[model samples]
Structure formats: C-alpha cells, structure tokens
Target: MGGAMKIVLIDSNARAVSSEDREVSVGSLTRLLGSKPAVTARLPNGDRLLTAKEPCVDNGFTIGRSRVVVGAGVVVGKRDAVGAYTPPKTNVDTLTKLVRWVAPDNMPRESEDGRTMVTAILVDPETRDIRQVSLRSDAGSLDGAVGGRCRFMMRVTTADAVFVKVGIGPRAAWRKDGLVFPGRSLIVGCSRYGTLVDVATDIASLRASVEFKSPDAPDWLPPSR
Candidate 1:
C-alpha cells in the first residue's frame, strides 16, 4: 500500500517505473484515488458494517474515520469504517521541537471537503523571528495529467537558507459552504540550503510556482518560470 504513494518516475525510455515498491498500472491507481466519494464505506464483521465516515486528520496526515454509528450493517472486512490512523511520525529532534512549539498555535482554521492545503512557518532560530507562511488548497489545486499523473502548481522557495516546518491539515465539511474545520493533519520539514534570506515572505508565492525550500542537498525544484 505504501508503494502506491511513491512518486512515479520515468526511465531513459520515458517508460514509467515505480521507485519504491510494487508497480501499479498508472491509469487504474489514478481512477481509484481521484474519484473518492465524499463519504466511503468500510467493512466490519462478517461483511456487516456498523459505521460510516469520511477522512480526517490525526497528527498531520489523512485518515478515514467514522462519523456515523449504525450499530450493524454489512461487514465487508476487518478494517473498521474507523480504522487506526496516525500521521507518519519523524524522529528529528529539531523538527519535533519546533513543531511542538509552533503547530498548535498556528494550525489552519478553514474547513472544506476535497481540500488539501499546506501552511509553512519559518523561524530563524538565530534571529527568533516568526513568519506565517500559508498556502490554501484552492491556490494549488491538482489537475490534468496524462496516465493518472497528479499535478499542482505552487511557489515555496526562499532566497536564503532557513529551517521551515510545514503542516498540512484536512478540512471536513457537509456542504459546499459550511463552517471551516480543523481535524486532518500532514506535516513535513524543509531545510533550505544556501541562503533562503527571503523565504518566509515568499512562501505562498513560491508554492504558486511549485518551488519549495530544501536544506540538505542541491535544490531539487524547477527554475522559476
């Protein structure tokens, strides 16, 4: 299942290959992931279901959890409509500390279905300045790729090196225009090498160009267009 999430890559012949795990037909995977219902089903005991629900965030990753209690219905599998879900955790101390310090205070407050958004906060430990960097799902909606290709455009790079903690949350809603929600979660740490002197102020714009900050190796993003 994890392999399904690896970014697809092309070989010298331009043929797509799976880098991490089992290879799946790109077309099929795309259809399965793309057309998820606003609500989905989960199988319980003896193909009987006792609940129904939608996806939400725990920690900082997407998860399907129960919203309705039906007592009993049709059991499909052992996986509950509300299964055990947790954000993928990282062991980096710096990131852990920073996220602990900042996330609760700055998590996004909007809620909507089918929305995936990232909010970046850059802190200059040396300078102790905090800048709120946010990107809305609307700003970088994924679309239009051949053969189940997933894509989006956003600007997220800094001119100077900096340590950035990015947190992504899922918004839950019952209607097109309802109260904003805060439940789903996804978090990633980015360290930009060189000098990301202006990263904080330009995060949103950077994401708009699909450019993001990285600290470990050479920048792996496309040049500004």
Candidate 2:
C-alpha cells in the first residue's frame, strides 16, 4: 500500500478517528500485533472453543509519537480483488414531534414537511474506557437545512451499519386540511460503500482497513514508539 493509508482509532462509542495517513494495508496489522495466538476457553457446557484474537492497534511509527489504533479493523485477505474487514452493522432511530403551533407543546418546531435525517459518531461515553469524544448536541435543531419546499431534512451518523429509522406516530388534524399525518419512517443500514440496506440508496462499498490490538500490547507495547 502507499503512504496514503493512515491509522484509525474508534472509541467504544464506535466513532472513528482516521490517523493522518493514507493507503492503510491489511498485512501490516499482523506484523504489528504479532500473529494471532490460539487460545482455549471452557464453555458452560463443558466444551472448549478455540478462538483467535487479532491485533487491532500498533505503536506509533517512531518513539515519542502518538499510538495508532485502527478505528475499524484490518483488511486481511482479498476476495475478488477487494480487501474487506468484518463489516460493522449500524442501527439508528429518529423521532419527530409534530405540533400545530410553536410553544411548549411544539417548542419552535421546524416545518412538518421537511426530510428528517440523522448523523452520528460511535463513541464509548464511559471515562474508564480510553475512547471518548464530546458530542455537543444533546437536543436542539439539527444543523441540516430544508429545501424550499417544506420537506424536513435530517442526517445522522453512527459506527456500525449506518441505519436510519424514521419517526412513527399518530396523525394530527389541521385547520381545513382535516387530517395531516407524519411521513413514513425509514431505516437505512448502509455499507461503507454507500449501499443502503433495503432502500435503493447509493453507498460506496466498504474497504477493509484495521483490526483489534494484541492482548499484550497494553503492557508490552511502548506508548508511542
């Protein structure tokens, strides 16, 4: 791979941080983590399951550099000339509260007609966990803009499969219109490649990049070297 590939670190939240590099390769992971070692664990049924723990992180390129961990996973072998990691799954939900007026009941609601979308970043909020990113917005107007037509526009992001679940609720009757109902909700699970799960949405295919870290890396691996 070229020098373009950089390392990525994904916190427990699943949000990803792409190391400032390009052309990340798969074989590099095995070298950094040392090959996977076979481990044995007894199951509750008195049976043993053999498993392999792949390395997902590596030391910094040189001494005194920041450590680098692949946000996603490493790209191992190629299938049909395409390098791919274990694809992450995405799940998300969107809720909309429709009100005839702007007040405590409605709270300055945007036009009921715009598209509602969402964007998210995966991050483990626990402080004990090394991964944490501050998501400023708790509850407020989404930054996205709506089209001239009154359609609502919503966007969200997440780590696993990016899934979009539209709002679902009862309808409301407006002045003269009689019964005006909310739009149908949508659940989209897109591959890294941009392919939506059920809906016919264009998504770029996901390419493999990183993997897990070696079990001993926490201790034996230098902080940045």
Candidate 3:
C-alpha cells in the first residue's frame, strides 16, 4: 500500500502558498509544480524535498530557518508514489563499489630488493566520479596492482594530475603521460612499474593522464599543458 502524500508550494521566504494531499507521480507533480521536480534533500524522517530540476527563480520560495531557496519545492513521503516510493535516479554514488585492477600480463618487473609504486587517476564518464588509487608492488615483484574506488562522487567535469612518480625508490622518477579517453569507454590496468594500459569497454570509459611537476616548482604554479 502507498503512504499518504502531500505537496506544498512555497516562496523564496519559505512560506507555504498551497498545501494539499495528492498521489505522487512525476507527471502529476510536474503538472502541479509547472516544471520537472528534482529531489533536493532526503529528510531524516524519510520525507524528500523536491524542487524544480532547473532554477525557477520566478517561482522561488525559501524553506526552514536557513532560508533555502526552493523554487516550487515539494515535499513527499517515502511511500507517497502511486505504488512504492522509488528514489530519484542518480548517477552520483552509483556502482561505488571497489573495482579491481586488471593488471597486464607483461607487467614490468622490479629488482628483488626494490619496490614499485604507481599512482592512477580514474574517472567514470557517466557519473564523473573521480578516484585516485595508489599501488605498490611486493618487494622484488611486479604485482603491486590495486583497485580504485570513489570516496566522494562529485560532479566535477575535469581533473588533472601533475608530477606523477612511477618506479622503485631512487629509480622512481616523474613521467609526462597526458592521455584522455573521451567518448570511448575503457578499463584501466597499471603495471607495478607505473605503466598504464587501457581496455575498451562498451558501456563507459575512463580517462587517464599524467603530467610532471618539478619538485622545485612553487605550489601555486599551474600545471604545464
């Protein structure tokens, strides 16, 4: 069974203009709000705060003591939908589980006493989830491949890594590898010795790139193109 649903149209000052009980559905809410609604917040009590997906300053309203500007915002309960309440679809935080690395068979080998290190930056094209992973090879072996996972699924459009170090101690040095895999989707594999490999995938692609930032350079210096 579905829970009772309520819709309230508020102004920029957070005052409710009209409040009523209604069956929750995208179409019904869109028609009432005069625009597509976006879930802005998930309340502690399982209620959701929804507002126009795009800014609607003309019909803006403020809510709470914080005065959040929720233009045409609507509040609904968890089970307010026609059937069961289904949360809004979001790429953010989706598939956030750890992804294992697909190491190459011919990964570079290091000396028995030496250690290999690699730093990889991975981004999900769809969610724009950026993650940094550090991998270290066991002493004397080239099998230091680690997986990558997103700590925070941000809406960042771009990411850059300057001064990437790959290799064993003393032998570890910076490399200039700027690569972008746009449009095409691919999985990433990193060798213990800091080599990056790409495998094409059908659904989504990852972007990998590296730039050298001199140790002596000032912190404020922008990365070289």
Candidate 4:
C-alpha cells in the first residue's frame, strides 16, 4: 500500500549496525530484537527505540553531535508500526515544563526521599517586590514533580486575580482526613485560571503577606460550648 517502512540499528557510538526494510511491525521488530522496545528519544521524522541487549549501559549513541547515553543499540525508524506510543506529556514531563516556566533561572533538585523541589522567584506587580518560595511535589521520580503542585504555584504567582478559601470540618463528618485538604484541591482550584506569565510574581500581594498556622492553634479549632 505504502512505501515499506525502514529501520536502522545504531551502536552506542552512533555507528550503523544494520538495516531492515521490509514488512515490519512492532511485533516483528520485538521478535527480531528479542525484547520489548523502549522509545528513548523522538526525532523529527521518527522515534529512536532502544534495542540493545544490555539496555542499561554507560556508553550511548549521538543524535547529531550531542551524546545520548540512555541506552546502547537503538533502532531508528518511523513510529507508525510501533505499539501504543506514549506522548512526551507525561506527568513528569509536564512538571518539568511547568517548573521551567515558573523558574527559568533555577533548576529543579531532587531530595533523597524522591521529591522534586524548585525555587520560584515571585515578583510583586504592584510594589515590584521580589520573593523566593520553594515549591515541592512528588511525581514518583527524581526528574520532576507532579504537575498539580506546579500548576497551583504557577497560578498563585502569576494570576492577576486569585481567590483562596479555607474551611474546616469535623473528622467524623468527612470521608477523608479533615485536618487538611487533599493536594488535588489546589490543582482543581488553579485549573480555572489560565496562564498569564512565565516568571513568578506576587501580583495579588497575598503571597508576601500570607501566614501559616498550626492545626493545633486555638483559632483553627471549632468553637465549643
């Protein structure tokens, strides 16, 4: 029906190992390579699938002059025949993008406990004051944090108008923990606001004045007779 799909196998040093141009599908490619292929990178025309016998290795191939040490032998070909392709917009990837958007000058760091933290420099649009705050979240990896937290922080520091509400309920009245709201709440709340700027700024003036109180504080407790 169409031109036969072609695949090129390259070694760790970007040397061409072999080429196969025939009736190629993901199943056939897997049988030929003897392992499930993992897409290590995406090119303009196709994707690079890791086909090395030892997928985990120090040495790797180069895409132009840049060395990509993610895997050993890699199969380069069109992704049409590959199995369900996962877009690069995974939670971790999104988190990374948002982190960069909110904190262009700082890089995200990973803690030993596997949380990602980024320092966002917020600028007040009114008085032009600047404040730096650490945003942390867990996305199950060291590469980035969850998108939810980053998105919340993004709105808090960027939105021209942001509204925040705090409420408390009896532990027995709530299905989940009543002491604190789930982190997802922030994500849902911020979803209503669209991104307006990249750099973090306290345009709302609330960031610099907000205070956190312990749950044990008398005012936080419900009034009793």
List TM-scores for all candidates, in order: 0.19, 0.17, 0.30, 0.27
User: What tens digits encode model 2's per-residue C-alpha lDDT throughout 1-225?
Assistant: 323333332221233222333333334443433444222222233322112254343211100111112122222111223433221121111001110111121111122442222332221111111121121111221112110122222323341231112233432111101222122212232223221222222221110111122322332111110
Candidate 4: regions farther than 4 A off = 1-4, 22-28, 31-34, 46-58, 65-67, 70-225
Model 2 ranges off by over 4 Å: 1-29, 33-73, 76-152, 155-225
TM match of model 2 to true structure? 0.17
Worst ten in a row by lDDT for model 1: 139-148
For each candidate, the alpha-carbon lDDT, in order, equals 0.25, 0.23, 0.37, 0.34
| Clashes in predicted model 3 | 11
Q: How many residue pairs clash in each candidate?
A: 35, 58, 11, 1
lDDT (tens digit, per residue) of candidate 1 on 70-94: 1111112232355522122222232
Sorted on lDDT, best first, the list reads: 3, 4, 1, 2
Clashing pairs in 4: 123-201
- lDDT of each residue in 1-225, candidate 3, tens digit only: 233454544433333344566656777777656678777766555666677676544433223311233355665556544555634322212211211222234232333544333344433332334455443322211122212211221212222212221322332112223343331111233322223322222112222232223334433222232
The alpha-carbon lDDT assigned to residue 36 of candidate 1 equals 22
Candidate number that wins on lDDT, 1 or 2? 1
